[model samples]
Target: MRFCSRWVVRDQWHEVCLYEDYFLYRTRAADSTAPPEEHRVENGDIADIGVDREGPLWGITLTVTSGESRTVPCPATIAAPLLLRWHDRD
Candidate 1:
């Protein structure tokens, strides 16, 4: 499955594309005059996942196999199905 949403990266909002195995993101505020900053993260290294709901926002925390973790926020409406996918995996 694939999903497109807004994600916070380096204190800025960017358009992110999430897939089952990885995610891709690009800064939305960059001007066309300059190349947009892009990044990707592979899910294979993710060892644990957690979810938190704060009003309408959903915070997803992913822990890497190496013990690093980061939380990213997205709307609950979009996160519900994604969380379900993770649940089904287990």
Candidate 2:
């Protein structure tokens, strides 16, 4: 599976991270060959997570802040009626 991600900074494109399985395949930024920022999530990191699923659509919350979050709707290529639960913080 391939996913496209765009990071915007100051109203401009900042960086992009491509994930293939559990590894990052490619990371690009506006002016540097390296990623704009490095994020290290712990082995069991779960913060501000939410889930949404309707009919044949499966959506997952990617980022959340102050109780507001963004959901990325997965295509039907992904299994439907899936359940996504937020892991409790340890």
Candidate 3:
């Protein structure tokens, strides 16, 4: 996968959006219109990551400081590209 852009805010993970010809993988604000927060990731930190693709849906794991992870389905706009790019990955 190739990343079109990456962002960090306030020294923590804010969002990451990876893009290809037909797909985009993004982690964005829940409100859609809210300004992105400031976070940063330093070296040696264990960043937990998860990805899921089922049927027409795609999901990614969201990890909090508490160690619990939540899998959230990608929105339709994102799902379309995800599926297209995933097949390309193969």
For model 2, how does the per-residue alpha-carbon lDDT over 1-90 read when each residue is reduced to its tens digit? 133444433333332232332212122345665544444222233244345667654454544233444454443333222221123212
Scanning candidate 3 in windows of ten residues, the lowest lDDT window is 38-47
Off by over 4 Å in 2: 1-46, 65-68, 75-90
| lDDT score for candidate 2 against the true structure | 0.36
Higher-lDDT candidate among 2 and 3? Answer: 3
Which clashing pairs does model 2 show?
none
- Evaluate model 2: give its TM-score: 0.30
lDDT of 3 at 82: 38
Best by TM-score: 1
In candidate 3, position 6 carries an lDDT of 40
Ranking by TM-score: 1, 3, 2
- Candidate 1: lDDT of 24? 60
C-alpha lDDT (0 to 100) for residue 68 of candidate 3:
56
Each candidate structure's TM-score, on Cα atoms with residue i matched to residue i, is 0.62, 0.30, 0.35
lDDT of 1 by residue, 28-48 (tens): 442344555776678787676
Error of 2 at 55 (Å): 1.0
Q: In candidate 3, what are the lDDT values of residues 1-90, reduced to their tens digit?
A: 343334332332333443332222345555456555443332123134446767554565544455755555644445455345544543
